[model samples]
Target: MSDYLEMSLEQLQKEHAELLAFNEKLDRERNGYRKYAMKYAKKVQMIESLFVVPSDDHELTIKAIKTIVERVGES
Candidate 1:
């Protein structure tokens, strides 16, 4: 192989490896975000189930608001 061709091949291989590493890092971040989203969804679902009332009462609405405020404050 010519000297120039060998050098070019090495550079390409290095770039390929860097791209692969970057892609893996992105995959890890995406997975983490997915897990966090699922957790947040579950928390919201729980809160809704706990506070949702059958009647449209102002006091009940205020209580729900307070509950949410307390929950957020704890977090």
Candidate 2:
């Protein structure tokens, strides 16, 4: 913050522009992940619906699906 205060107008302007560009890039990436999460959630819901019977196997399957999705997102 002190560095910015000492910077000339042109330097500050350039720094501001660079920061804005980086922020936009982050926003784009965040939006992409949000879309992916929504799609994956919908798919999980569909799979859950397919298993009408409530049993240990069904619970395990759902847990497995959630874990896989989480791992994939991390990658």
Candidate 3:
């Protein structure tokens, strides 16, 4: 704190600009993680939906599994 008091206006402005840039970088990274989490959550929900109702149709189960595998592969 006392060190800041000793800084010139130019120094303070430079430091402020650097901090702002770093903050923006962190925000971008946070947003990326948030998007990834949402995508993963949707995939998990899809998997859960498949099991929610017990289905005796083997063909339907196979199709669902194939769809899931394709989606996973795409990711």
Q: Best candidate per TM-score, number?
A: 3
Candidate 3 lowest-lDDT run of ten: 66-75
Models sorted by TM-score, best on top: 3, 2, 1
User: Which residue runs does candidate 1 get wrong by more than 4 Å?
Assistant: 1-7, 55-75
Clashing pairs in 2: none
Give the top-scoring candidate (lDDT).
Answer: 3
Model 3 scores what on Cα lDDT? 0.83
Off by over 4 Å in 2: 53-75
Which residue pairs does candidate 1 place in steric collision? none
lDDT of 1 by residue, 23-54 (tens): 99999999989987876676577567765556
Local accuracy by lDDT, each model = 0.71, 0.78, 0.83
Residue 38 of model 3 has an lDDT of 81
lDDT of 1: 0.71
